[model samples]
Target: MNTDIILTCAVTGAGDTPPKNPNVPVTPRAIADDCVAAARAGASIAHVHVRDPETGAHRHDTAYFAEIVDRVRDSDTDIVLNFTAGGGGDLIPELIGTADDDRQIRAAAGSDLQTPSERHAPIGELLPEICTLDCGSLNFGNAVYLNTADWLREHAALVRDAGVKPELECFDLGHVWFARQLIDEGLIAGDPLFQLCLGIPWGAEADPATLLAMRDKLPVNAHWAAFAIGRMQMPMVAQAMIAGGHCRVGLEDNLYLSRGVKADNAELVAKAVDIIQALGGDVATPAATRETLGLRGAP
Candidate 1:
């Protein structure tokens, strides 16, 4: 165990969990407020994704993201701003039965299926301290999380050029392999930071053995965090800390703190902190995380 860990709160994600839990913050202000609360509760970093304030649909609007970042930066928080660069590659192929017809299947939805430049556009504009670069794609629920090798390489270079540190999000062991390839290609600078997503359907399962298995294959000298969806959230915090990786938690990944108990971002971070302390571990502060990740000035 590393004893020292960086704790992150993914405030609200782009997933379709809005209807299930009314507590998930969708507006920029709500998300920003949650980030501040999480920081005060012990989060060194806040992973952000903007949503359509009205419908609660996920959005990739730079302006909306900018508002959240600005609000958090101006408030009583010094949490590391980690913008989402994982949009634009969303390709929900239209189910227009036959390929011969220029007929459209389902129109492309979600921002992750975009081209490399489109994906990199917001990061260049917002220039947050850090951003996420999903190394590859997998089936996220019913949607095919989309990312190709070429696309990864292209966007990695752009993220590198933007002078923003990227926390590589790896949904599986192969994604970690691709993160290593990004390092080899010299597109990702600094000591690599990785987020191991667990218990996502069709991806890595949320279990001690599976977390350990995927973690064992991490690149040497890499800074990694592990997360499990729903009930596994806080449990994985201990698993990650004991295994020498950092931990991330929030409502985006889970809704309940316990049976019938709904949680906010602050509650999630608080739970992670308690677990870390119980394990005799220290949670990384924003300054400590910035130093450890070697984040450069944003573009």
Candidate 2:
């Protein structure tokens, strides 16, 4: 088992979950605050996704990212920042017209497709220590997360050039396969970092066997973390640590501290820390995590 592990708290996701739980951080200020709190509660890193401050909808605007980055940087907390470069890939086909044309397919109400350059703009500008590179496309719920191989290659190159580490988010085995190819093509430098995302609908199931299979396929020297959404979040924490991988927890992946308890980011992180300690494994601090992941230090 990997005794030393980096614990990341995904502060807020791009999903419409704020209505379900009031503690979910929406504004840049709230996100930055929660990230600092997570760091104080023993989270080595904070994986962030910005949303519309007013509407609470997910957005890729560089300005929103800039404010969030600045707030975190100006704080005393020493948490490593991992921004979400994984947005703008949501394709809502149900919102499209029945015109039998490519434009009809593109003309969806919730279709939030963006070019690779658009996705990389915030990360490239703000320069977080690490940003996510969602490895491949999958049937995400009712919509499709359109991260094509070509788009991933382009996104990887952009992240590499921006001097930010790419946390490869792989939801399935094929995603890992394509990530390895990116490494082989020299788009990703140094030892790769991966996030084994499990339990999303239509993706890999949140089971021990599935996680192990995905873990076994990772490149040698890769630093990987794993997380499962919903009630399986805490169980996967122990499972991931036992399987010799790092762990991730927070409001992004889960909402409950227990069956009926709604949890904020810090509470979720603290719970993970408790689990790691109970398993006789120590959580890595920000400095240690940066060194382990070969990040350019805390930013």
Name the candidate that leads on lDDT.
2
Which residue pairs collide in model 2, if any? none
Q: Write the per-residue lDDT of candidate 2 for residues 1-299, one digit (tens) a residue.
A: 87898999999999999999999999999999999999999999999998999999998888888887788879978899899999989997763555557434453688798999999999887888999999999998989999988999999999999889999999999999999999999999899999999999999999999999999999988988899999999999999999999999999989999999999999999999999999999999999888887888533
Off by over 4 Å in 2: 94-104
Question: On residues 205-275, what C-alpha lDDT tens digit does candidate 1 reach at each position?
Answer: 99999999988888888889999998888889988888989999998899988989888889888988998
lDDT value, residue 160 of candidate 2 = 93
Name model 1 segments beyond 4 Å from true: 97-112, 297-299
The residue-level lDDT of candidate 1 at 12 comes to 95
The positional error of residue 236 in candidate 1, measured at the CA in angstroms, is 0.5
